[model samples]
Target: MTDTFKHHLELLIACVIYGTVGIYMQQLEDMSIGSIIFYRIFFGLTALLFYLSITRNLGQLALKRKKKYLLLLGILYVLQMFSYYSAIR
Candidate 1:
């Protein structure tokens, strides 16, 4: 398969997985929306960290290029998420 095809397929799968998780999040009736979002992010990060550790890629995070660009992107992502949650509420 071509690299472009594989990348698009991966993006599709990621969207499906994210949609599935969002559906499940709505069923947690006892938790506040904030708590649900917190758990979702915490678990997602934990799983990502575990995967990186197992793959020995955790060390590469410190050596990534364009640190300022990445930091800006991270901040933008957080702001986007906050805006999304606010809109949902």
Candidate 2:
């Protein structure tokens, strides 16, 4: 089906982008590893927020229902990233 083909194409492109992150990171050795990780998170968060806003999905997120869990999850993500960045460096 055409839908399956598009799904595969999307996965392929995601793979390419993920693969390219290594090359991009390799080019940024002069920057502090924290800076690199911060920039990555900042840009990714900004883009994700923008996409959600443009699609008017933020209003549908029901954050009030999961505020505590979401907050904990976010903290966990940051902590995990700190360790991951250290390992990557």
On lDDT, the candidate that comes out on top is 2
- Which ten-residue region of model 1 has the weakest summed lDDT? 21-30
lDDT of 2 by residue, 1-89 (tens): 69999999999999898667657766887987778768888999899889999998987656668788889998898887667656665
RMSD of each: 2.7, 2.7
| Every model's TM-score | 0.68, 0.68
Task: Show the lowest summed lDDT stretch of 10 residues, model 2.
Answer: 80-89
What ranges in model 1 sit over 4 Å off? 63-72
Model 1, range 1-89, lDDT digits (tens) per residue?
A: 99999999999999998667556655765677667667867998999999999999998668468989888997887677666655554
47: Cα error in model 2, Å: 1.1
> Candidates' lDDT values, in order?
0.76, 0.80
> After TM-score superposition, what is the CA distance of residue 12 in candidate 2 from its true location, in Å?
0.8
Candidate 2: lDDT of 14? 97
